[model samples]
Target chain A: ELVLTADMLVEGVHVPRHVAPADFAYKALAVNVSDLVAKGADPTLYLLTLCLPKHPEPGWLEAFTSGLSNAQADFGCSLAGGDTVSAEGPVCLSITAAGTLPAGKMIHRFSANPDDKVFVTGTIGDAAAGLALIRKEVSAHPLSGEGAMREFLLSRYFRPHPPVAAIELLRQYASAAMDISDGLVLDFTRLCAASGCGGIIEADRVPLSPAVSALLEGDAFSLEAALTGGDDYEVLFTAAPGVADAIRSAAESRGLSLHCIGSIVREPGITVVGRDGAPMQISRPGYDHF
Target chain B: ELVLTADMLVEGVHVPRHVAPADFAYKALAVNVSDLVAKGADPTLYLLTLCLPKHPEPGWLEAFTSGLSNAQADFGCSLAGGDTVSAEGPVCLSITAAGTLPAGKMIHRFSANPDDKVFVTGTIGDAAAGLALIRKEVSAHPLSGEGAMREFLLSRYFRPHPPVAAIELLRQYASAAMDISDGLVLDFTRLCAASGCGGIIEADRVPLSPAVSALLEGDAFSLEAALTGGDDYEVLFTAAPGVADAIRSAAESRGLSLHCIGSIVREPGITVVGRDGAPMQISRPGYDHF
Candidate 1:
């Protein structure tokens, strides 16, 4: 069987105007490859559609292709074919990735059962904090002024490491899965919605990186904002409680960590319990493009 | 197995700024489907990546999506998924289409032989002429003044009919194939290049719509432009002589036309034979984006 998906990145929207060309290309491929990971499909080939401005910077194409080569090497996919056209708009990149899976083994978002435990790969809110740091929207305290934590968050925002290695494990162990391109709260809810179930997320269990934790300790950012921030590119999934150890071991072997945030429920709505063990209201779940 | 391809449409490049929103959407989907048709694969799914300008017209999305729905029904492909983003520049659309072919049965452009005969589906230069007419670049006499002929040319430009019905016939007979998107002459030459052979094209045998013929007779459009005009969306293929009759009969049964315009040759370069049976020089073969 085959899995297909496409994601487009427009300058000033998905990538910052001042971002490095190579980083822009990396993010373009990363976002799409992340989708393949959710399906438990091995990333194989991709086509790139590039819309360029007239007389772009001399090194833009070279650097961009270099970045694409790097990601191609990282994700183990080849560049198949694509189209390039000149436009008067900001640079736009549309990458279509193809993944192959064994018959009857492709994972989906709608397979989660009511009693499945919700699990998330890697740290969730780091990319969200990374984005906020890049945009200067949060000045959260001495942490922003002191450690290399700011650079760590910025790196997450610019160059995400898509977890393609976890695909087979997820397909083998998980009941439902999807990549966290949108915020974790929204994407997890989307998975629940697809499976016709609900979730109760313990907000404290939502994993955060050391950088994010430091920022929170300095009162520079809030846990609520992290939960709703987008562009994480992590895999959010649910599986039976029996597979927890194997999921953790697989992620550990890859030099990454996994977290169990909460559990799937029989209800039709999500309840996000605060760190203080009380249910909290979320005004907005995640990003929406119109 | 799955076959994938992506093409981009940018304002003032692929489409005119004044074209209907629905028409633009149709063209975006049509171009990608054409590639799938050339591969002799059944287009089963497509992903649309749209970069829209800020503050687009109120009804634009509705009309655009309606056009997509119509084309989706016409092509028999469902919208699998996509991404939408706001751009600060011209509207850009990137569509990635997926087609499935039996294992080891997919057609290729590099498989033609020197003894094969080249054929093209439908009319070749009508869309190119349509583009010129739409841009007010051609003002050729009574033909341009005629109502039905003018609209015929314009329709070819805005809405292309991909040859989805003829895939089986082509795959069974043709050794190599590709869609004539960049113009018959250029795309045919590309096929020859890939197959490591040459071509001898008889100018008079080239297919043309009634509007194009009338334009040529009235000195409204040049035959050179007709030969090298792009955006035809016709399938160009090379088949051995033994199956020619079967191919022709199949096309007839489907209410479409086919023309044997040229033959692959042992030489290493293409020879464009004029109506007088002599070689002719092509100043500019087709469109090229740099």
Candidate 2:
């Protein structure tokens, strides 16, 4: 087959209006590309079905298209066809990307094994923190006059660097891998569900930016929020313990951080453990698109 | 790649609510499959993304999925993946059907010949009349019993039995072809535009169903409506004049109609002529998304 496609991105739901147009296009294509990446497919071609605001400024379109072009060039993909429509409400973009995988070699969500070391590429919770900071800046007081923290948070919320290359690399050794768009804990739960297994997650071992940590030091609930918040766009994979060293080496070779945050187990439910070994559960775990 | 993709069908756009949900899924997937058919791609997999009403009835979903399953089986495609979400307003369905094309041999839109004979695979105006009939039925009055006009219009409007097999067979000989989703005149004009040439279509040679003819006899504008109204998923192609007979013969062998609507001219614009060789123009020509 020559196509792999999916569409979905509603304004105010998948993204916010405050985001840069270029970032919107980048994240839009990235989400679709991540689906292809999860299947161990290389990006080949894409079509954009855009429901844009009427009378969009030319600069916005230029920025958006430039972002799309950059992502396309980076992944060696081409734009083939698409539809553009004027919408009266918030802008919506639905993209379908098609890629090729070796015949009979496509990876699915299922197929995991007990004792596989669960790994995550890149730091988590940045996007969630960024959104929080944006809320604070807009609704409350401006936070520190566009300093590093604000810029980092806004960038994370805007252009989520999709783990396309990392996913492609992990496809070779990992039994199951998916981008953490819908938060770590929830997505990990889904991965476990798909593979018919449970997981043993370590709370302290999970990476968090210092800014996120500084915002609420003792609020353990916030840690769960970071775990369950969507839009991180980092790759979470599972590999056998024997390959942990190799996974770390491989990820480092590509200038990516590979953290052994947890492990797969034979049980059928999630159990998150703090440093002292007691199980912990927090509310507001993740998003569900009902 | 093992994925097939397409775009969203918005309410008040793709179909009417009076139409059954079963037909909605069929039209959604069929139109997408028509694209693959034009590429000589074999349908094998599908993924659907739906933006639905707040509380869609089970009957609607069941009928929709049934229609999708039917199309998949007919085309030998599998339902591989999907995501569904509730929208704030109006229902939308995005379906991507994956199909394989011979390596490095996929057909594209920009490959028409200057001296090719133009052919359309089926009758064109039935779908437009079908939409008209649907509007009339809803606002005017329902005809008693399953009247012939009502049944005919309903079939054309709802289940647009696109000639996929005919398209598959014609792909071998046709230089450039595409499904006529946006009215005959407009779509044919697009073909000419893509091929970088002109066309002279004979108005008298344009096929119309008996119902359309009846509707047009007392109304000059109804003919224009039938000519330019959109959503006819028929194959339109151009080829060398020398191969026209063989093409017609091949179509006939498969129990399909091959209409010789006109000739691909050397000029640079689309022109339609009546029996008296007078220039023709129709109002409300084709569909524009924005």
**Ten contiguous residues with the weakest lDDT in model 2 chain B:** B137-146
- Tens digit of lDDT per residue, candidate 1, span B234-264? 8999999888888889889988678998899
Could you give me the TM-score of model 1 versus the true structure?
A: 0.93
Write the residue-wise lDDT of candidate 2 on A1-290 in tens digits. 24375757876777776467777888788777777776678878877777666688769889889988877776678887676766555666677788777776666667778999888877788888777666563321233343776677667777777666675566677888776887888888888889999998898898887656655363422676677778887777888899888878888888877799999999898888976789876565577776
Q: Mind giving the per-residue lDDT tens digits that candidate 2 earns over B34-111?
A: 777776677777777777766787688898889888877666677866677666655666776677766655666667
> Predicted chain A of model 1: TM-score relative to the true chain A?
0.96
Instruction: For all candidates in order, state the fraction of native interface contacts they contain.
Output: 0.87, 0.27
In candidate 2, list every pair of residues with a backbone clash.
Answer: A3-B3, A4-B3, A181-A231, B4-B96, B4-B97, B4-B98, B5-B96, B6-B96, B116-B239
- Docking quality band of candidate 2, CAPRI definitions: acceptable
- Please list the C-alpha lDDT of all candidates, in the order they appear: 0.87, 0.73
Best by TM-score: 1
